[model samples]
Target: MSAALSVINLAVLARRLHDTSLLPALTPVSVGTLVYPAPTSTVEINPNWEVLYWNTSVYGVVDNSVILECGTTLPDLYIWSFTQPGTEAIKAVVYNLGRGPKIQKIAKTLGQLTIVLKSADVSIEKLLLAANGLFTCQAFYNIDEDPKVHYYYVHLTVRVPVSKPNLLMTGTPVEGSKLWMHCSVDNGTGPIKYIWKHETQNENITNLNESNSVIYVDDVKRNYTGWYHCVVSNAVNTESSDKVWLDIKFGPDDPQIDVSPKTTSEWGYTILETQNVSLLCQAMSNPPSQYLWFYNNFQINIGPKLTITRILRNGTGNYSCSAQNSYLNTSSSRTISLTVYFGPDNPQIDVSSNTVMDRIYTAVEPENGYVALETQGVSLLCQAQSNPPGHFIWFFNNSQVHTGSQLTIPKIHRNQSGNYTCSAQNTYLNSSSSRTIHLTVYCECHLQQY
Candidate 1:
C-alpha cells in the first residue's frame, strides 16, 4: 500500500468517473498518511479505530431532518455509529462494513454536500426525541504500517413540540381544602414551562406564575372558585389546555338588610303610616343563600326581600333576616327595628285624685262635667293617642294657665275654677287637638256643716 495523497476531492471525482465511464465502475479513493496523534479519549465502539475526533453540533425538532457529514474526502472504508444519551453503548448504525447494525430504517445517504464542510451527507430523516444521541462517522484510508482515520461526529439534540396540555385537579375543591392543579402532556420536550390561568366572573383572567407541571394552593375559599387552565411552552411550540371548572363550596355569611324609603327620626328609622317600604336581605355564599325574614321574632316571609304595600302603625316592629347555606348547613342573621309614625287623635281629659294615695279614682269625663270643692287639692290631666306622645299646653278661661299635660292646684277658691282647656300638639304631624272641661267650685264651710 502506498502513502500518496490527493488534494482533489475524490468523492466528486468518483461521481464523475461513475457517470462518464472514463474508468471501470471502480471508485478512486484517497489514501493518506497519519499526521495527528491518536486521541487520548476513547469512545464506545466495537472493533475501535484511532479516534481522532472532529465534532459538530446539530439541533432538530420532531418531524424535521438533520444532515451529518463525514468532513473528509472519499476514503477506502467509512463507519458510522450511534451512541444513546447517558449511555456507554455504541452501535455501528450505518457503515461501509457489512457486519454492523443498519440505520437504513430511519436514514438515507443525501446527494447534496454540506455547505461549509463540502463533505458527503447522511440524513437522519424525521427526527424524534427518542433518537437523541451522538452520531459518529469514521473515515479510514489504509497505508502500510500507520493507518489514517478521521472521525466526524455530530451531537444530535432532538426536541418535540409541546402537545395540548391536559389540566387535572387533585379533587373536588372545597373550603379549607388544598388544591392541586397539574398540567400534563402525552408528548413534550422539556425544559417545558407551565403557566396556570384563572378565569373569574367578577375579575380579569389571572396568570398564576407556576413553572412546574403541578402547583398547589393551600386553603381554598369560595372566592377562589373559577375556571382554570394551563399554558405549556417549549422551544418547539406553545400550547394551552382545556378549561376545568373549580367550584368551591363555602358558607353563607352574616345577612345584611337594606330598607327602602329611607327615613329616620330621633327614635331610629321612621316612615309615615301610608308609606310603602321594602326590606332586602343579602349574604355572600356558595350555591346561593336562602333567606328568611321575621318580624318581632315571628317568621313572616321567605326569600331575599319583604315588601309591604301599605304599611300601618302595626307594621312597626323588629325586622330580622336569616341567611342559610344548605350545603354547609350554616346560618347567619341580623335584625332591624322599623318604626311607622302615625297620629295624635282627639285629646281628652283624665282626672286622677292625687289628694289621697290610698283612695285614688280616675275618670275620663263625668256626665255632669267636672266639679271641685274649695280648699281641696285638684289635678287636671290631658291625654292623647299618638306614636310619640305630644307636647301639651293648658289654658284657663281663654287665658294661658300652664305649659304641661298636668295643671295641679293645691288649694282652690270660689273664683279659682272656670273653663280649663288642654291642647296636645304632635311635632311630626304639625297637628294639635284640644279638650275643655267646665269646673264649679263650692264653699268649704258648707262641707264642714255637713
Candidate 2:
C-alpha cells in the first residue's frame, strides 16, 4: 500500500462511521493491513480482506474518451483517486449515494465526463496529455461497513496524430550532382515514420522505404526528374505532403534520324533526281536539343528537319545529325547514308575471241567482229554503270539466250555465228539499255591473201 492508497482507505472509513470522533487515529499502513487503536465507543469496524491492485495500461488519443473500469458490479461506496508526477487529480464520478451524478474537479481542458453505472466504469471525455497518470478506483462492496478495498488501477498514455509533411529540396539538382531532400512536419508525435515516392515523367512509379526523414540521390540523372512526395505516419494517423517537382538538367541523348521517301538500296536511302526526300532528327533531353546536319561529314543544315526539293547524285553520302545540349556543353550525333540514282545508261558489248593457231591469239573487238575459224572460242561481256548494278539478260539473234553480265561460246560454228544482243536492266528504276554485236566464223580456205 502506497501512502496515497492509505489516505484513500482512511477517508472511506470516516464516511461509513457517521461519527468522526469514534474513528481511530489514522496511521499510514500497507494496503490489506488494518490498524485499530481500540474504538472509543462500542461501535465495531469490519476489516477489509484484500487490496486489489490492477496493472493494466490504457492507450488513447488526444481529445478522445476512455473508460476506467471497476469490475462489472457497482460497490456500495467507491472513491477514485489519481496520481501524476506533478498534476495529481481525479474526476469522472456520477450518482454518488443519493445525489444525482455530479462530475467533480474536471476542467474544460479535461473535457466531458460521464459515468456508466451498469458496468461501474468512469468515462473521461476530451482527454488531454495532462490526464496521463495512474487512476485508482477504490470500491467497497455489500451494504456492510466492511473495509474491504477493491482497487482498479489504470495507466493512461495519450497520443497525437501525424500532420502533413513538408518536403524541401536541399539544392538545385543537376546531372551527376548529389541531390538531397528532407521531409518535416510541423506537428506530430514521436516515432513517426516517413516514406518517399518518386513518379517519373513517363508514369513509372518508385517507392523508397526508410526510417529516416532525409533522402539522397547520389548521382542525379535525367530520368530522376519527376514528382516527389513524402508520407508521414504515426500511431494515430497517416498523412501525405504535397508533391514537389524535381527537374534535373541533363544532356541531349544520342540523335536518331527518320528519312522520308525511305527506299533501301546498296545506298542507305535511294531516291531519283525527280523525287523529294526528307530527313528528321530527334533526341531526349531536358531543355530540348538543337540539331545540325552534315552531308558527307560536312555541315549542310540546322534544326531537327531537313528537306531536299530535288535529290542529285552529288548529295549521295553519309548524312549526319548532331544533337547538342548547349547548357551542359554536351552533344551526340547519328549518321545515315543517302543515294541519288539514275538509269542504267547505254550499255556496250565487248567480244574476246581465242584461237588455237597461236594458243594465245587474243583481240578485243566490237560489233560485226570475226571469230576466225569453226573451232574458235569466244566470250562477250555487257557492261553498264548504275546506282544499284543492273540485272542483265542476253539474246542470240533477237531471242533470249542467257542471263547475267557474260555470254560464252565454247566452240563457234558457222551457223551459230549471228547477232548477240546484251540488255542491261535496272530493276529498281524500271529502265533498260541495250547494245548488239555480231560474230562471224571465217575459215582458212577462204583466205583473201591470194
Candidate 3:
C-alpha cells in the first residue's frame, strides 16, 4: 500500500518540529521504509548543521539493493543516537533611540556555535539583534542519513557627525589694552552652548560654560575698539571665527618753549658782549617735544642752545625754558633779561728794575736769568703794565730770566754775576723787582817778562 503511505508521512514531519522564534527551521524525518531486513537507521545532529547527504531504497523485485554510508559505514551507528544537545545561550540588548534611556552593556565568549559581537550598537537593527543575526542553522547525522540546514543574514550601516565649536583669542589686542575671549569643544557631546559677541555691542551678550573659555576685560576703552567674535554651539553644529581688531598707539605730548634774542639788556647793552651767548628752545608735540634750559634758576647744561660761554656780569640773570612729552608739561620764553659787556680793567704790574741788593749779587744768567750783559752793560729791567701790554720776566739767582718789557745785559761779563730778579706779568697783575750790578770786565793786559 505504498509502504503504508510512507509511514504516515514520517510521523507528520516529526510533529511539525519546533524552533519557535529562534529562527531558521529545517526538518526532515523518515525512518525504516524500503523494507528489507531493515534495522539499521540512525540520524542525529544538533551541532548546528553538518551532514550533507544519506539515501537508501531497497526492495526485492528483480534488482534492488541500495545503501549509502559515511560515518565509517556505521558499526552500530551512534551520532548521539538522534539529535538533542544544543544549548549554550547568550543574549544582550540595548536601545536608546529617542535619546533618553542611556544604554550600555557588554559580554564576551565565543566558540562552539560561535556568535561574536563585541562593541555593538552601530545601529542597523542594533547590529542584527546583537549578532544572533536573524538566526539560521541546522545539522543532522546518522552517518549522513540525509539532514542539513544552514543560512545566515546580517546587515548594518551607521554614521554620526555633529561636533564643531572653537573660537580663541586669549591674547593680542591692545587698543586701550585688556581683552580675552576663548571658547572650545573637542568633546563633551551635545546640548552645548556659548556666545560672546561684539560688532560694536549689539545688546552685548555673554553666556559660557563647560568650564568657560575665557572672557575678561578689566579696562579697554575707546568704545572698546570694534570687532571681536565668538559663537559656538551644539544641537548639531555651529561655529564662527575671524574677527579681531584692536589698534592702540600712544604718544608724546605736552611741551612748549621758544625764545631767541627776546631781549631785555642792561649790563652793557646790545649783543651781550664779554663773550658767548645763545638762547633758544622750541618744543611742540604729537610725539616730538623735549627741551630744557634754565639760567639763574640753575639747570642749563648747555646744548639745545642756552649757552653762555662768558657773557659775564654774573651771566646776567633770569632765563628759562622747559617743554616735555609723555603727558603734559610746559614753560616757554620770558624769564630772560641778560646783558653783559665790559673791557680794559685787568692789568697792574710794574717793576722799575731790580734791587733787593740786586737780588743778592746776580749771576746765574744762562740765556735768561737776568744778568745778561753785552750791549752797553748794566742789564736788568722788567716792566709789565696792562690794560693790554704786560709780560716781562727776568730772574738770575732763582732761575727764569728775560721775557719782554725789558731785561738787557750787554757786554757785561765776569760770568755776568748773579742774583738779579725781576718779574711782571699781567692779565691781572704780578710784579717783582731786585737789582745788583757789580760786573766789571775790561781786557787789555800784556806782561811778557820772563
Q: Cα-based RMSD of the predictions, in order?
A: 9.5, 9.5, 24.3
- Per-residue lDDT over 43-105 for candidate 2, one digit per residue giving the tens place of the 0 to 100 score: 234443444545567887788888878767877656555555343233333324424444555
* Runs of candidate 3 exceeding 4 Å displacement: 1-17, 21-178, 182-212, 215-240, 249-450
For candidate 1, the lDDT comes to 0.69
lDDT of 3 by residue, 1-450 (tens): 122322332333333343221122233232322111111223353455343333322111111111112223212111101111132121222221123222223311111111212211122222211222111111122323433421111111111122354566655343346666666656533455566666654545343332445777656544554566666655435666566654432222232333344443333223434566666655434334556677787876533556556566566566666555444343344355454533323322222223211222335423323222232345344443232244555666677766665665544555655455554444432333333333332222311221
Candidates sorted by TM-score, best first = 1, 2, 3
Q: Name model 2 segments beyond 4 Å from true.
A: 1-48, 85-120, 142-144, 171-175, 193-195, 198-212, 221-225, 263-268, 296-300, 326-329, 343-450
State model 2's lDDT. 0.71
**lDDT tens digits, residue span 1-450, model 1:** 011111122243334334321111212221132122122344332242243658677777878777777765655556565655555444555555323323443333222112222334566566666667666675655423334556676777778889998988896577888988888898877888888888997767998777789988888877778888899898889999998888898768788788898887766678778889998999988879999999999999999999998899999888999999898898999998889877677777875443322211337433436656777788877888777779899998989989988888888777975678888888887878888777766675755785
Worst 10-residue lDDT window, candidate 3: 76-85
How much lDDT does each candidate structure score?
Answer: 0.69, 0.71, 0.38
Clashes per candidate, residues 3 or more apart or on different chains: 0, 2, 27
Query: Which parts of model 1 are misplaced by more than 4 Å?
Result: 1-52, 72-77, 86-89, 96-119, 140-149, 265-267, 352-368, 373-376, 428-430, 442-450
**Candidates 1 and 2: which is better by lDDT?**
2
Model 2 clash pairs?
Answer: 1-31, 95-101
